[model samples]
Target: MAEQGSGGNVIAALCCVFFPGLGQLVQGRILAALVFAIVAFGGYALWFFIVPAIIGFIAHVWSILDAAKFRRLS
Candidate 1:
């Protein structure tokens, strides 16, 4: 919303800690939120497989970092 490392980004990153994509939603990125949610959850749903589980974990972490690093175009 403001800039990278801003308070809003910090809060968004915290939100993502609870659930992947929640931070994107907080940042008003509907498409990104949906994409992250689907990818992370889809991988998680197939957690019995090692690769998918790892993918889910990576996606979750990526979502947090993405939110934390996001900078508005304006």
Candidate 2:
């Protein structure tokens, strides 16, 4: 796995705070990035209904943490 606590990881985490999947993209996790973007945005689009909106919030936070913790395989 890639070494942890790099400056890039911090930047990626920050990116995720603004957009869920952006951090994953920064970390080279293309597939995960696409999935996170779709799910997070999709959930937000449904936010008008209220219930499922919570999923969006959850996904947002999850993405941030996931990006911060992600490690690339060597």
Candidate 3:
């Protein structure tokens, strides 16, 4: 079996990598994703060295994981 949300998940993950929250929006995880995105972006605005990259990496990993998990859902 391929996966249910594999496509959306991949796209969302990529979006989040490029921007953020966009992945969550694609995954339909609006609230948490949006919040995470905002915080990550805001923090990055002030300190664009370590934290932002870490946050963005986390968000990307999260997207891939979420997509995999989506397979078990429906």
> Which one is best on lDDT?
1
TM-scores, in order shown? Answer: 0.96, 0.89, 0.58
Each candidate: what lDDT?
A: 0.95, 0.86, 0.61
How displaced is residue 63 in candidate 3, in Å? 5.8
- Cα lDDT tens digits for candidate 3, 3-72: 6556655676567666666666666778857776777666566565777767756655565455434543
Per-prediction backbone clash count: 0, 0, 0
Mind giving the per-residue lDDT tens digits that candidate 1 earns over 1-74?
Answer: 68999999999999999999999999999999998888899999999997988898899999999999999997
Sort by TM-score, top down from the best: 1, 2, 3
lDDT of 3: 0.61
Where model 1 places Cα greater than 4 Å from the true spot, the runs are none
Scored against the true structure, residue 53 in model 1 reaches a CA lDDT of: 81
> Relative to the unseen true structure, what is the C-alpha lDDT of residue 33 in candidate 2, on a scale of 0 to 100?
91
Q: Which sections of candidate 3 miss by over 4 Å?
A: 1-5, 48-74
As for candidate 1, its clashing pairs are none
Model 2 agreement with the true structure over 1-74: per-residue lDDT tens digits? 26566788889989999999999998888998998888889889998988668888888889988888877776
Q: In model 2, state the lDDT of residue 4.
A: 62
